[model samples]
Target: MPDKTEKDQTQVPFGELLRNFVIELIVYGILIAIYFYVALRFLANPLAALFGNNLAAYAVISLGLIVVQAVFLEFVTSLLFDYLGLHRLSSRPGKH
Candidate 1:
């Protein structure tokens, strides 16, 4: 029996890797952008109501919440995709 080695790992072409990376960035960017957009809107409405139409405070708090939510959601989503093997599968060569 032969021992498995780290060198046995398959290498992806640089061009393909760059292309796939760009695609992943586009996908994640769109999803995360939408998520934060909705989150900001949702947070702003209630803040406005609670603050008696004070737009400045509402904007500040809502922006803070949006930033936090975006970071947390993005981290969780990235981890979930990795754990589910989605990222790894996407980088593989297509079968003909």
Candidate 2:
């Protein structure tokens, strides 16, 4: 027989899970919207020119921009989640 510690036995309520999920979704949506707006507003002309001038450079730049966006969004989301006192669904017990 296996011993069940309190941590192992505990379960998150569905309501709390749903709430956290909703909050995360909303935050990500807003962040993505803002990111797109800023990217398009500032980089559109430059990227368009690059694309016209050099295909390889444009492709590399586009890929780099995507990576940057993903990292930035994830970083911001973590900060926001900490600030909002929300626990990540994927986080495991005893792990920061």
Candidate 3:
């Protein structure tokens, strides 16, 4: 005789789980592409203009700008997720 709970369970396909993971990865990749586009297109030129003819200073300034843009991108992505109703459990994984 089988247990009632066992009999009542419905099996979810592993393909669905794999597909979900893949889709999430794809979304993250798109976000990364956006980050780089914003960083280079909007950030680099102004930073270069600020430190004209100085390769070292321009590199350092651009690096700082990149960091700031990365943080800004993460915030925008989080806001987007919340707007889409996919609330994040934590900003940093495994911290909770």
Candidate 4:
């Protein structure tokens, strides 16, 4: 029976799914951490030295940097998925 066939399909364990999701979250967290570390460690001092002290300006600059970092992360993750051969199957050609 179709119902029996469907019922026989393998199911992912809940713990395995949770573990995968957690791992992905930790990976993304580390990426964000590296972004902030690089920003503060390498760029912040030079930027402050060049631009002078203005809290509002620094805040705006930091916000822009965060947005850029997030976009960069998305692109990097897409590349990684492709490189790892784990890119999700497409329903249509040239569509992610």
lDDT of each: 0.68, 0.75, 0.63, 0.63
* Reference-based lDDT, residue 70, model 4: 74
What is candidate 1's local distance difference test score?
0.68
- Candidate no. 2 TM-score: 0.66
- Pitting candidate 2 against candidate 4, the one with the higher lDDT is 2
Best by lDDT: 2
The C-alpha TM-scores of every prediction are: 0.45, 0.66, 0.42, 0.46
List candidate 4 stretches off by more than 4 Å: 1-40, 47-52, 89-96
**lDDT tens string, model 4, 1-96?**
333222223344657655655666677689769877986688967677646767778778879988987798779777655444334322123312
lDDT of 1 by residue, 5-93 (tens): 33323555667656666766677789778966987677666776967878788778768877987798779667756654446645555
Candidate 3's TM-score reads: 0.42
Residue-wise C-alpha lDDT for candidate 2, range 10-91, written one tens digit per residue: 4667788778768878887997798779867898999899999999999999999989877987788888676554654434
Which of candidates 1 and 2 reaches a greater TM-score? 2
Clashes of each: 0, 0, 0, 0
Ten consecutive residues with minimal summed lDDT in candidate 3? 87-96
Q: Rank the candidates by TM-score, best first.
A: 2, 4, 1, 3
Task: Tell me the TM-score of model 4.
Answer: 0.46
Give the clashing pairs for model 1: none
lDDT of 4 at 96: 23
Off by over 4 Å in 3: 1-52, 88-96
